[model samples]
Target: MPANESTNSPLDTLWRVHAILWMVVAGEGLAVVLALATETSSDRLTYFGRLSVAIQWVMLLTLVAIYALRKPLSRIRPQGVAYVALCLLLINTWVTAGIAWLLMRDVGPMPAGGWQALVLRLTGIVLAVGLLGLAAFQNHWRARQAAVQAKQAQLESLHSRIRPHFLFNTLNTGVALVRRRPEEVERLLLDLADLFRAALAGPRQISLEDELALARRYLEIEALRFGDRLSVRWELPGVMPAVTVPALSIQPLVENAIRHGVEQLPAGGEVEIAVSTTPGTVVVRITNPLPHPGSHSHPGHRVGLNASQVRIEALTDGRGSVQTQVAGGRYIATVRLPVGT
Candidate 1:
């Protein structure tokens, strides 16, 4: 299975070294108490050692088998995960009992009835451990899924608000210039169509190239609206990193720059968009001339900025962030994203 597809189940989450170690330790501790109570042997250390070694071997072997089967297991549906887990537990118990039986027989004469009883008890104990572990894991998985669903819903809500606001603004721009620049209207409409098409795309994420194209279209409309007042300066790297970003993320920051900074200035100003990469992160910076004092400002821009910031943070699970500030006569919005995002 693909690495990305492996994270879909709770079973996969439980198959870690630390978790396996915990299970082995807990199971062995319980087994020691049971063995000491049931056996008449005066040498408690020998009895404890036997159970410890058996439990350790069984757990280690089972862990290895689980690791080998993880790819196939991860593809199983949520409902089937428990059944598969129980089946694995049964197999692990039988293998462990066989090994323990062999070692016990070599050590000394072992009664057949005693061995049979020991195997049954071991199977029951291991099955109980498996069931408890599965329950805990399933609960954790449900909670995680709930959180993701909530975040997704919030993002979609915020995204919906942004889409209509942008559409109307673009439509109004087109309407305003329809008669004066009849020829430009065709190109304007095409850009508008492309923007909406991208907005309505299947996934909530899009490649950096697609995102940049969408932002450029928005800027194109703003350029038409502001005429010579809006200038764009791009400092893109030689090659754009193949990274995915939350859709509609960059364009909103660009819109904020045009709305609050460039248009507010008397002679207009430049919106500089720069993209660069570090070892594991991709950074996007948008800077525009700071708004002059007493300049008209829309309060909605602040709300929109906050919303976009929240959406990006949610999509990247807080690995990505947005920061904005006015310093050195520039209103700067910077986004830091992990390359894997």
Candidate 2:
């Protein structure tokens, strides 16, 4: 299996939870909506109440079934999803059948096998409709997964493109300072090593502290090149919260500030990086002097920014975002990540 797919495999989610409970809750909500739409006013409450009970029973039995068969299910392959769906179907069928039996047991003068026959018919209809819905859900989820994988691949490609150009520039800067400032060259190489390590760490997330450190290293290397012209100011909290961010997410933004903003001016400029949090969101703002008009094309400018935005959205499941603009002679980039506990 491909590494990304392996890392994100659905099979690994078999015995794990959270996503399944969310699915159950969503299914119950849809059932409530359907009942409200189709059932009459007087019967709506009773139907809704019965459905509520049925959902509870179904969820309870589903959990039991998962507990009993978790070991075997874990070994089930890519077919794990189908097997899980089948398990839920059977559990729902039996639960519905039991409820139906209890309701009809005291009915007047029914034939000996009437309840069984009714249950068979009801179960057949329920299974038919339920399986169709499950199949639709599976298809939709697969399509979404495919799209996420494609986006991740694109972001990785963007990351790979960034490293080469950045390394080349930093190396040239190192060569320039090699004879004049040999000791600084050692620090420069160490910073470069740290920057590339985070870059090639794949598409996983790292802590905010670590990401900030990576960005600091990148700025440090640029500082070596620009010396006093490339100053940086950091506005960080005294107590850094244990939040996570996409690897290399902040560094690329800092690199953009250095390459396009400060480097364009003869006197150069200072870059400001501020980290703050509000309620459940972690906000990072990087500000640098805007480049002169028509000076040069910033290669990979949009590419890197878009990739970083996509990665943030993907990492936070759309709870994070990026915004950039040139305002008041400063190019400002802001990233907001949902704080994770």
Candidate maximizing lDDT: 1
Number of the top TM-score candidate? 1
Candidate 2 clash pair list:
none
TM-score of 1: 0.76
> Which portions of model 2 show Cα errors greater than 4 Å?
1-78, 100-113, 141-145, 200-204, 292-300
Query: 55-121, model 2: which lDDT tens digit per residue?
Result: 5676567666766765676566544656575668676767776875678568534533576775575
Model 1, span 5-72: residue lDDT tens: 22455665456567667777786887677676765544778767767877777766766776788778
* CA lDDT scores, all candidates in order: 0.77, 0.74
Q: How accurate is candidate 1 locally (lDDT)?
A: 0.77
- Cα lDDT of candidate 2 equals 0.74
lDDT (C-alpha) at residue 25 in model 1: 74
